[model samples]
Target: METVINLFMEKLRNNKGVGLFYFSGHGVQHEGENYLIPVGASRVLRAADQLRYKAVAAGFVLASMKAAGNEVNLIILDACRNAPFKSGFKGDMIPPGLTTMPTVPGALIAYAASPGGVAMNGSGRNSPYVKHLIAWMEKPQLSLNDILRNVRRAVHKETNGIQSPGYYDELNEAFYFNQQVAVNDLAEQQRLAKEKEKLQRQQAELQAERDRLAGEKKAIKKEKARLQAEKERLARQRERDSTPITPTGSKKVFRDRLKDGSLGPEMIRIKGGSFRMGDIQGGGDSDEKPVHSVSVARFAMGRYEVTVGEFRQFVNATGYKTDAEKKGSCYTWVGGNSGKNWRNLGFSQTNTHPVVCVSWNDATAYAKWLSQQTGHTYRLPTEAQWEYAARAGTTTSRYWGNDPNDACRYANVHDNTSKQKNQGFSWTHHNCTDGYAQTAPVGRFKPNAFDLFDMLGNVWEWTCSKYEDNYNGEENRCAGRKSGSLWALRGGAWYYLPGFVRAASRGRNSHDDRNYYVGLRLARLL
Candidate 1:
């Protein structure tokens, strides 16, 4: 796989556009860190073997789709299948499934389930996930994320709560398998295609006219050249002599950080589904243990994390202030003198900036407001859901790797000195960087393989689970159970080191405990 990824590097060139890759298989998490098991597994997969296996890290996915380089690169992972062999992996039952070539911009990646969650075994000859995914690939209506949502729900019902699906992506341009080819109406697409053909014919006629006039006497030639040019010019009209232009709003909108680095608005589709859910590892928390199945019906979920613009829409509609804005708190260096208040951050932020410094209440408020605005259910991703997405289709510890240094690329964490000092990793300041000084704009960095952003670090996102002390009483929690409901938070923030960002890193706080580093992203059923 390492050699294959390297080969992709050779083919990838600036200006060529996007790239994409998809993968599926076993993922392991320990002490809150995640790791994707590779093809040649050792008796037990460990942090050390990861370096040897050369497993794909989340950072590698980001660097490959560098927005500045080849347009955009996207990746999809269908991992998250429940597999045997956890603590000391010794397995015949476990199998590393499929993976694909790396993809660049003008690409799309889709996942079978959320990261860290398992996919259901197909009840039919083909697994439910596989059958539905195959169907999605054959059609053109569903965008990458849209079809996966269908597959996600199908497998959930097929397994009855044994697994959930997820994915990640970083695309510079939109590349749907089949977007409304020229807007939905068949007449519209045909009209556009005809217009393009007419322009080509006219351009050819004008070229011929110029050629015909070029042989005339010198003075006549000059005079005739002007005439011919005018005639040729009209011949290339793209609008078609009888057509009217489509209204501005009627045109399909496209958003991207294109070859020239432009940003624009893009429409999003919501996906929803039901699935079986639970951990294969024996240590599943009470809520995750016993691994019964669930039947999450279909619903919509955003394809990517909510942008600052999207969140602002909610704030504008509700006139609601997040906990941080209300409390006048700012993100502070864990030990910095400025850690006193939000005003200390020293900058006026905008609506397009991700709303940071939130508590669970703030996150939930935003979700509620969004639900009201869009008339759909919206809320923080559950712990299982968040992991499934964060993993995209991977199960690697930390998404990227065990190395803390590599995290700087995908997340704004303590890898650099100033950030480390602020969020608390002061001891390793040798290679620290205070680059942005504050949060860079959302999506400023690259995305994970699934096209999801900030899954590893940036802000610690709130989840829908209550934190528990241990995984000791597992069985009771798995059977349609409800334990502590204070809600747990997953994914590390800029305040912590990369190690803490590992999927296994867990934290608990009251619903009202707001901080400069807390924020939220939402998910829904399909």
Candidate 2:
């Protein structure tokens, strides 16, 4: 058997074609090595020394084939029969079946049964594995992998999961046993040539469209830069001509009276000024790039984020339902769970805590209702106005400074307290501890430079600007309610990391999507 296999391997040397070798005889494994039994062997040839001289090593066969350097090679072994030397071999000295063989490039080795499994010889002339393999190979247009997979499934099902065929394949190119050819070869070649030409033409058209879009994007960016420059110039002229209102003292604070004689949210006057928007301190996302100067007009912004009590007032007066309440769901830390809403967030929140689980649409509706009740133009702040007020004349990463360790004193970010309470929380947190684990009271932490409470933490505040990849004119103006666009969310939530709690960091969501970390702050034009 060894001499015959060597002679066969010489025929395949440097052939540059597909080669196949199949064996259907007894095989055995000794000391983790596979050997094939030859015909007319001695019945008592069970010792390792005697078998080494008569039996053919399977490794030698594979190594010789690899040296042949064929383009593709396949080896099939249906030799995992019951052990014939049970009397001579010790108990469990040799395993039931063959060991796994190492695979080489451009080769596939198939076994009739899985490693350490015994193959069953059917009552017919051949085994069940060989029967399925022959049947599948005769079918045209079936790749080699597909044929083997079908054989494995059929044999496993037929034997009730007792026997399973397996293969180790490293074939670089697709291979089919019986490939089909077109009847009219010349006509088929002409049709394929036409199809290729059409495909090339379509690709050319796509490239042209992409180029046109690129040009339009460049032009839009240029127009945005021109408008921003004009805005800054106009703002400087207005500042020189008119007296600026001092943003300090109690005179800048005011509250509107509702029809029921109740005072509305406390509003702080933000003095008009020009500031460079977007990530200035580095280590930010691409969406915060291409920072530009934006001049904000004087506006009154809420001193604190809208609390649950304030939102409840609006809902009671108008009998309104929030988006989360209407949809009967809200996205939380564990994901969107049914029966979770602003009222029942699976965590305790007092009336003083910031209102969460509110969508952009819900925030806008609340603002409109507040305006009707107080007779004032109240809405969500623009992205530019929110960043400018949050920064308050400083250019550091955070309003307090670049040090994140100082976060616990000024903001309720993810801290040691929350991490200790929730064992599953594995995110990076501030080393210091904030007293509360969940949403802290609106004014529990220190305020920013503008005297705004919870400007960078507790809960993210909704803005009226439509989200864009870069700073366009939309960041400076409020987006219309009817536009189907994602609204921006500024600040960071209590569960957010320190990197996201910066003035330049931005988050966005769809108009109707509600999240537990999002809330709102009112802004009024003066």
Candidate 3:
């Protein structure tokens, strides 16, 4: 079953379309973590012995596909053969329930029987659950909810009420698998939305300061607050894009909104100045040396980092294929295994998880896609721009502090103290697991002096400068990507020791290297 899933996952890495998984066997649940009893699945989910298959089951799968971590996700689970290993659950384990479980955002889990009941098996080779699932999936134009209802009825009738299949057990909303809504629909929806009234008001209040600089009239706190009304107007101005219009409407008109500013947000102002680009701290790598102060131009950045929801918008608009999406595999660091890909990896994330496994090219493509969609010049932040925004105006080596363990608290660093050692005594966390033990929520931890989060630890951020082993102390006087050397990476990752996280710490990896730790932030030239 693991092999089968691995094969399917190989396919899942790229295609953002509908996905269907049919587990044809037993299932179990302990302590809210569900388990799919793979062929001869044993009581333990330990990987030490592959003697029998054990997995975090339909529960884990359902949660993953729903990763809508900014993209929409849908899942269907057909296994409910029998709760074979129910008795073997160890301490702190909760029995599986079919009817209901706590809700996961952007996720819906289904079962073959009502919560806490056994699933019915067929007298023939196939399980009663599988028959209904296969039949229902073949139905046309059936809303996901209606199909589930139909499946529950059929399974119940076949089992003579013995197996009452549960779907959206807690009544979680079903995302219609057949009528897939692509990015364009969602963007248009946002286009007509007057919802960002509050957010607009907030940005508007900051505008006076946004319009201010040295030698300018200082914005009084009250004046900034007074601009909330103006925000309502901008919300209305922005709201024109969301109204659902006919698909036959002129493409050029709609294209104009996206390009000109259909659904654009205000830019985050970054103060331009000089700062040491590479790590000057001793524990950092040699590549981090030749610390040089380079003057950066001021620019406005996306107030929030690009989000999964936003990325999905870009894909829907252009039908763009990401590198990983095209490759049919995504590089992920596997626990207990040295290498892994998208199929085995699960995507349980809030809308906030930092986009991971994306390449420098992929990041750039997204920025480019956004520019085309909304007619904005969004691109990966230059090395200088990223630091300015990340610092939010703190002079410390780390935005939070020099402590790397503290990184675990605020960002998703080496928080797996049980697997690794826990050194951070006082720290922050994104309030959730980093999923891959690699990437965490974008906003995890408190923001820096500038209100930016996860700048020092979590994932390695990409920069624009070409890699140079020895740069002149005057970085402004440096040359572009030296021969053989690639671009630089900053901050550290969960897998790295603390030494790599210093603000000035510098290191370089190949442009072709796609690992779990690499991700990038974007900035636009004013």
Write the candidate numbers in order of decreasing lDDT: 2, 3, 1
- List TM-scores for all candidates, in order: 0.41, 0.54, 0.44
Better of 2 and 3 by lDDT: 2
In model 1, the runs with Cα more than 4 Å from the true position are 1-309, 325-331, 334-348, 417-425, 429-434, 471-485
**CA deviation > 4 Å runs, candidate 2:** 1-249, 334-336, 482-484
Q: RMSDs, each prediction?
A: 27.6, 28.1, 24.0
lDDT of each: 0.51, 0.81, 0.54
User: lDDT by residue for model 2 over 58-132, one digit each (tens)?
Assistant: 888888888888978899988876444421131123455688889799999999999867677764446789999
lDDT winner between 1 and 3, please give it.
Answer: 3
In angstroms, give how far residue 58 of model 3 lies from its true place.
Answer: 43
Question: Per-residue lDDT of 253-333 in model 1, one digit per residue for the tens?
Answer: 223332234332232232233333344333323333444433333323333445566666556667877666666554343
Kindly list the per-residue Cα lDDT of model 3 for residues 1-526, writing each as its tens digit.
5566555555565666444555545555544445666554453432222322446455556545544232434455554433422112210122433335555554445677777665655644456777777678766667667878898898889877767877653333445556634546777768655566767778888865556642243456335533642553355345445534334453211222465355653345566777666564455445556566667787665544455556666667778765666665554423311233222344344546556666566676776676666556776665556666666655666776766644544555654331323211112332222323555667644555544556677677766666556665322322243445466666666555455555665555555445555666666666
Q: Give the TM-score of candidate 1.
A: 0.41
